[model samples]
Target: MNVLSVALSVLETALVFVVMVSVLVAAHEYGHYIFARLFGMGAEEFCIGVGVRPLLTWGRRRYRLALSESERAALPMAEGALDAGEPPRELNEETRFTVRAWPIGGFVRIKGMVPQEDGSEVRVPGGFYSKAPWKRLVVLFGGPLFSVLAGVLILFFLYWAVGATRPAGTSIEGIVRGGPAQAAGLLPGDRLTAIDGQPVLEFYDVVSRVRDQAGRDLQVRYVRQGVERETRLQPKLAELPDAVMGSDHLPTGEMRRQAKIGAAFGLVHVALGPVGALAEAVSRPQQAVVGMIAIFERKVKVEDSVGGPIALATMTDAAVRQGILTLIEWAGILSISVGIFNLLPVLGVLDGGQMVTALIEMLRGGRRLSYKVQNAMAAVGFSMIVLIVIGVFFVDIKRLVMPSRPMPEFVPIEAPKR
Candidate 1:
């Protein structure tokens, strides 16, 4: 890539990453903000980002009851009091606004977030601790629940925007020499009709069937030269390394040899119906848990497995180079992953924190705990998450810095001279 083009790519990648992270963080904060409002707890501030002042301000808005004439008349005095550099005679309780900041991570600073002594003179009714157990539960759970929801929406947009692969009739586009298909005389231009007796619609479906039926005979039906035929072929059992779609580390020759399974007959549909979306949302968490366990067990290495923003962009760029269908495949994998990770039960950070509080409530007989303790515990959990994010960032850096493997040299088949 030229310098300018490369720069553009980097900018695009950064933009996509920022959008993903900011949106996820905002969704999480919104959960807390919404629930706090619902339960009548006053949230003093809701801001995104950590350290810097916001580059721009979008003032918060709330529905206000119309003021009586006397109250309206008092507004000018209140304004005058502030303009005259004097404290307002009394704080007006009517108008409240949420302030948004430029930084992505945010907080819902609710009243009485910490505990107070029972006999303390400084008790506030709107304190977080004063809220009922159910209300607290909802408030705590909302952030992570919303994170998952945001992830689902992201996945949906990814699918809809990037588009899903339509499954067309399976046709052999290329062959690997000495491989089982090649050994069985499977050649380019042959349309695969069925696997055993089942009709085959897409090449990927065929791949799934073949992988499952390893070492077994494949009673494959194909059409060639305007004639339909059947051939019994066995897929060779060869160990393949774990890799994501459109990875560049794949053997160039191997990649070149593999058939392109593009332009399938049926559309890869994503139903926007509530049932489908909810099903996706519910299933994502389980998938994330399974994936996490697999990674922890070393069944999947972090390098070969996970992709943060950099990796995602690298993959996207590579996929775009490869073709459109591969991009869709990557989108599917990323979507499932985003869903799963948000559902983790790690306390204090987001969903996991909510789960933790719920579990604590269950143990404590439904009594509200000190909000201070809860917030403190959550802070610790959030710290842990920050550490993990740092680790992932390093991992991403390593991948970016590591040089890719050199493409292999291949000998060409000599055609017979006339």
Candidate 2:
């Protein structure tokens, strides 16, 4: 690649990564800040995005909302306040909100999150540890909850923007090799509407009718590209476990004769009402979580499927070529994944682990863990997190240096077209 093109790609990747991270971090930390505020548990500082340390020393790093003329007039007369063209903050006495130059990512400082030098949690009125265990649990769970909700909202917007995938009548996903459906010329994308003129609207309508008609010729009506047509096919005898043909849950090694015209069903995109869109959106995160969990039992290996920074950067660059919507959809998935990752009980390293502790405290009637035990768990969790990061980075670096298949060299704009 030309130096300029390569440079631009790097810049694009960095910008997208920073912006997505900021959005997700803000979504997560905002939950904590809001619940903390709701419970009257003070937050000391809230900062979003990153900036040069030098810029932080400029004209007015601190500011309060200019709500009304009277309030504006009553504003504090700090030295050099509001001197610059912009002061990127809205201030409050209890909690400070500051925007960094980059305007991406977030960091929060809440009262009593950390213990004092004496190794005792601050028990002040608005302090975190001072609250009841149940309140603390809510505060802890709030971050992941909002992250998941944010993902759902993002996905909802996506599904609304571009209709959701759902069953649209009955259509073929696959035809069993040399089977009745194949012999009858039933093809993928052909929407079957009826069997022997009986209306077919649901999945079971086809299944029930086909299974009972072994060796019987049946007329199947289907729509393809707005044209209605008919085909005749006879169900072939197939052996299945007695469970489906009968009522037993166990197979008992007994094969039952079942009428079958083998084909897999297909899905089509359909416009969703608001409620349907929300329901579908909610399901995506659940599916994402289950898919990730399936890694241990059934899913693909991490190196094969999981994407680290390099992979994300690559996708971001590609998505940038496609459009903003692609980026938004990707961000939604990433947000959900990050949220789920945090919910893994990793003690000091993740909110979920701390939540488990809070739950334990609540269950035990507010009895807290000892400093020693807490510290030990924290150390172990931190180590695990470090290992995870290292493993991901290793996989990324390996792919870069020794890709299984040779990657085409990036060509500059000036390069001759093949």
RMSD of each: 9.3, 12.2
After TM-score superposition, the amount by which residue 327's alpha carbon in candidate 2 deviates from its true location, in angstroms, is 1.7
Candidate 2 pairs with clashing backbones = 22-105, 49-104
Off-target runs (Cα >4 Å) in candidate 1 are 52-56, 62-104, 114-123, 151-163, 176-179, 196-208, 217-219, 228-232, 236-299, 312-340, 367-383, 403-418
> What TM-score number comes out for model 1?
0.64
- TM-scores of the models, in the order given: 0.64, 0.64
Cα error, residue 194 of model 1, in Å, equals 4.0
| Residues 240-285, model 1: lDDT tens digits | 2332222211111111112222112233453344544444434445
Give per-residue CA lDDT, model 2, range 47-153, as digits (tens).
77666532342222232322333323433444456676333333443566666766545656666787554544634435677678899889888888888899989
The parts of candidate 2 lying over 4 Å away from their true place are 49-92, 99-105, 117-119, 165-269, 402-418
